[model samples]
Structures are given as C-alpha cells and as structure tokens.
Target: MQLDSGAVAEGRVTRVTDFGAFIQFDNGETGLVHISQIAHSFVRNIHDHVHEGDTVDVKVLGRDERGRLDLSIKELLEEPEEIPRPRAIGRQSPQFEAKLRSFMRDAKERTTAGGKKPTTPTKRKK
Candidate 1:
C-alpha cells in the first residue's frame, strides 16, 4: 500500500538500532523512527523503549529527498513547543557555561577569604 504523509498506522519493529528503529507494516512498507522522534522526552537508548518484533504506532512525516519513509512516534503523543529556550544574555555554550559557573564560584570564595593586609614600605632618610 502507498503511504501518505500524516497517515497513522501500526507496524512491527523489524530492527532496532542506536540511532533509530525500522518498522515494517503488513503491507510491506517500512519506515524509520529516528532516535529523537522515538519519545517525547530525550531518548538516550532506543532499546529501552522498543525492541525487534514489537508493534508500534507511527505517523508518516513524509518521504525524504531519497524517497525513504520518515516516520515519528513522539509527534503523535504531543504537540511540539512553539518557542525555543532562551540562551544566556551574552553567550551560547554548554561547556563554557559550566566552566564559567565553576570559575565564578571559586573567585567568590577567594574574595571572601580576606584575612590579612599588606605592610607599607618604610620611607628612606635623605
């Protein structure tokens, strides 16, 4: 049977991989559910959610440029967010943000550890 975009159907999970799952329908049509599309939340492991021979509901996203069936499971479960998360005021970084936070904490500790004052130098005789 020909698959149409936005069509919902059930299929057997024929193959499961780290990146995605291959599902084969009774009509012999197969589609891919990319790892990111496998769940509403982050999907670190595809095997945790599905395995080979399991039946699953999928929605046809559309044929890609190569004509392969692009499917989704998470989209059917909920609507996507309308707005993206905001970044830091002046920077966008994962590593830098973490490192910056650590550095700031250490600097604060050093500043607050004040305990002594430096002695002034003596004046020389003319």
Candidate 2:
C-alpha cells in the first residue's frame, strides 16, 4: 500500500533508539517516529512510550532529506489543552499598585533632593 503525507497507518515497533523508534508496516514499509513526535508533552525517554514489538498508530509527517518516511504518533493523539498564565502583578492586585506608587514617590523624593542618585558601594584597595 502506498503511503502519503498525513496518512495514518498502524505499524509494529521494530526497534527503539535513544532518539526515536523504528516502525514497520505490514507492507514492509518502514519509517521512523522521532522522540519529539512521540508525544504532545516532552518525551525524555522514547522507551517509556513504545517498545520493540508494540503496535502503534502513527501519521506520516513527510519524508526526510534522506528520503526516509518521517512519522509522528503525536499527530494521532489529541493535543493537551493550554494552561492559562497568571495575570501580571500590576493588573491583578491593589496591594501591588500601592507598593509601586510608594516606590515611585520615594524615588522622586530622592531624585529631587540635592543628594546624588544612589550608587553601588566602591571596593576598597587592599
């Protein structure tokens, strides 16, 4: 059977390596599923996901520069929902605003004064 980009196929994991796993279809076509393509989340170890002789469904991402088929198991799995980031401090709380105002007032007072702006302490010669 001819496989094209984006085609989904079931294959057996023939070998596992540090970087990826090799899968062989029934028709004798073999492809590689890279570690990054094995899951939606970070994959620290490819062995944790697939082992030799395991059957997995993978999508054909495309061919590599070497003309080997590049596959992805992540494409067949549902993507994880994005987690919302925390709101910025200035926008989130009145306490933060009050602190910012106090800091700015202090800075303005220090600057308007005849004293020079605060400077880092100098090192003394031994």
Candidate 3:
C-alpha cells in the first residue's frame, strides 16, 4: 500500500524499542509509531499503551527522508475538549479521567522521565 501523509490504518506492532514501536499493516507496510507520536500526553513507557503483536489503529503523520512512516495513536483518539464532563472549581472530577489520562500519558514523554524532549520552536527562514 502507498502510505500517504494523514492516511490512517490498522496494524499489528511488530517490534518495540526505547524510541518507538514498529507496526506492520495488513497491507504489508510497516511503520514506526515514534514515542513522541504515540500519544497526545507525555509517554514514559511505550509498552503502557502498546505492545508487540497488538493490533491498533494509527494515523499517518508523515514520512521521514529515509522513507519510514511516522504514525500517531493519539490522532485517532478523541480530543479531550470534545468530551463532555462535569466541572469542579479548583478540583478534578472523576469524569475528567479521559483528559487526565491523556495528560498522564503525555507526561511520560518528558525527557527527564526518559522520553524525548518537547518540540522546540524553530526560527523562521529568511
């Protein structure tokens, strides 16, 4: 299959590394869901959300110069803002679990916790 940017597909994780997981699509194309792209929140451990041989749906984010496909599990997930929940002033509600989960997941992505550094702003080209 010709994987394009923004294309979404289902695949089984073929391998896992400190940096990411390799997903093999039914189409025989394998893509890497980088640790950074694994979730919307910080990701401390990739295994927490995905494991080898696990089937998962992912969104195609882009392709690296080497032709490796960059995938995202979070993109396939519903945005926190879109979910309905109860609001509590200066407090967290059990209903906020969905958003909380996302935050915790992304929290693991912190470099201090062994994940990649957050995206840095790039200088505009002249």
Candidate 4:
C-alpha cells in the first residue's frame, strides 16, 4: 500500500525507544512516531504512552530524505481543549483595579510625607 502524506493507517508498534516508537503496518511498511507526535501534551517518557506490540493508529506526516516514513499518533487523536488563563494584572477586574489604585495612592502619600514608613504606637512602661 502506498502511504502518502496525510494518510491514516493502523500499525503495530514494533519497538519503543526513549525518543519514539517504531510501527509496522500490515503492508510491511514501517514508520517512526516521534515522542512529540505521540501525544498532544508533554510526553516525559515514551514508554508511558506506547509499548512494543501495541496497535495504534497513525497519520503519515510525510517521508524523510532517506525515505523513512514520519508518522504521528497525536494527529489522529482528538485535540485537548485549551484551558482559559487568568487575566493579567493589567487586565484585572474593575474592583481589583480600584483596590490597586487606592493602595498606590496611599503609598505615594506615605512616601511624600517624609520618606518614612508609618510606625505603630508603642506602650510606655508604667
């Protein structure tokens, strides 16, 4: 079977390495799925994701200069939804902005007063 770029196929993992996994298709064609292509998220260990003899579906990313097939399992898997990030301090809510402004005003007032920080009143010995 001619495997073209973007083609999807089922293959059995022939070997697993620290960098990637080698898969052999039914047609006897072998491909390497790089660690980065094994999952959508960070893969600290390739063995944690795939092992020898495991059947996985992969997409043909294309061929290397040496005619080695470059495959990707993540391309065949569903992409994870992006998690929303908290707004930056500059883009904080109106309430937060008000609080910040009040604090800044207070600090500016203290600095301008005498460059001295406020001291708590201490009790004198009786």
Candidate 5:
C-alpha cells in the first residue's frame, strides 16, 4: 500500500536515534519521526517514549523536497490524559497544626495559673 500524505496507519519502529525513530510500515515504506513530533509534550529522550521494534501509530506529514516522508507519532495517537497533580492538604507545614495545638495548650495552662500572656523566646542580636 502506498503511504500517502495525511494517511494514518500503524508502523513498526525499526530503529531509534537521538534525533528521531525510523518507522517501517507493513508495506516496507519507511519514514522518519522527528523528536518533536513523537509526543505532544517535550521529549528529552526519544528512548523514553519509543524503542526499536515497537509498534506505533503514526500520521504522515507529507513528503519533503527530496520526497522522504515526514511522520508524526503525536498526531495519530489520542491526546494524553491530563493526570491530576498532588495538592496541598492545607496552607501550612505538615507539623503546623501539631505545633499550634501545643502552643494553645501551653497558653491555657499559663492563663489559669497566673492570668499572664505567654511570652515567646526572643532572639538577641548584637
């Protein structure tokens, strides 16, 4: 089958290079998938996403001036699902609540004993 421009099909990753991967289709037509086109996100290392002999669905981005097919793995694949990031349980340190609880207890005890405000240690700088 002729690998026409704008066609999307499954291909096998014949080889991977620092720049891109060479995808050889079932019809023996080969194309290069540029690193930027490999994924929607930044691809620091191509091996992190694709390896040799791996099957990938690719989109034909048409031929260059020399007639070599330009392919994009990102275009053919479904958009990656956005993963939820970890959010802070509260707006303070993990031990903040514990420290505040202890301070409150100490203040209450001090008030009952002498009705005086709790004094915090002060740093002396020369």
Candidate 6:
C-alpha cells in the first residue's frame, strides 16, 4: 500500500517513548505521534491512552519537507453527538483536585512548622 501525504491509515503501535510513540503503518512506513498530538485534552501520561501492539486509526494531517508524516488520532475520532444547548451558567473551570489537595497540604505543613499567621507582621515594642 503506497502511503500518500494526506491519507488516513490504521497502524500498530510498535514502540512507546517519553515524547512520542512509533506507529508502524500497514504499508511498512512508520511515523511518530508526539505526546502533544495524542489527545485534544492534556495528556499527563501516554500509557493511560495507548500501548504497544495496539492498532489505532489515524488521520494524515500533512508531511514536512523532510517527508515525516504528521498524524492526528483525535481528528480521526467521530464527532460527538451534539446535545441541546443549555442556559448560560456562571462557573469557573473545575480545578485539578489532586493538585489543589497537594497545595493545601503543603500550606498546612508550612503553617504548623512556622507557627505564625502569614498575614500578621511581628511587631517590636519601642
């Protein structure tokens, strides 16, 4: 199978690296899907989503002059069905609960170790 510049293809994950995964295209061509290109959302760990020997559908976005195939798995996903629009709501983005808990624990530790309020200044009597 001849691989074209903009053809979608399914490939097997041959190797996984810290920065990207090497996909072996059925045509015998291989390409790297950078960690950033793995998902539309933040990817803290690649292993959470993909593993070696797993076959995944990928879209060939384009290729650089160097002939590297740029692929996007997220783009190949079927569009999620749209639901009825909800009324406008005032809310902040959900916090990273794990990170928030860590910060709170650190703050408590600092307060206990220092034994003083951060906002109160120590005063010296004249």
Q: How do all models score by TM-score?
A: 0.61, 0.64, 0.60, 0.64, 0.61, 0.58
Q: Which model is ahead, 2 or 4, in terms of lDDT?
A: 4
How high a TM-score does candidate 6 get?
Answer: 0.58
Comparing candidate 2 with candidate 5, which one achieves the higher TM-score?
Answer: 2
For candidate 6, the per-residue lDDT at 9 reads 86
| lDDT accuracy of residue 56 in candidate 1 | 94
Question: Regarding TM-score, does 4 or 5 come out ahead?
Answer: 4
Tell me how many residue pairs clash in candidate 4.
Answer: 0
**RMSDs, each prediction?**
12.0, 7.4, 17.6, 10.9, 11.1, 9.7
Judge candidate 5 at residue 53 and give its lDDT.
90
lDDT (CA) for every model shown? 0.87, 0.90, 0.84, 0.91, 0.88, 0.79
lDDT of 2 by residue, 1-126 (tens): 777898999999999999999999999989999998998877878889999999999999999888899999998988879733545555658888899999999989887675666677999999
Q: Which stretches of candidate 5 lie over 4 Å from their true place?
A: 80-126
Q: Which residue ranges in model 6 land beyond 4 Å of their true spot?
A: 78-126
Residue 24's lDDT in candidate 1:
96
By lDDT, is 3 or 6 better?
3
lDDT of 5 by residue, 1-126 (tens): 778899988899999999999999888789999998987777879999999999998989999998888999888767768833556576788598789989999988977767766677999999
lDDT assessment of candidate 1: 0.87
Clashes by residue pair, model 2: none
Name the candidate that leads on lDDT: 4
Which has the higher lDDT value, candidate number 3 or candidate number 4?
Answer: 4
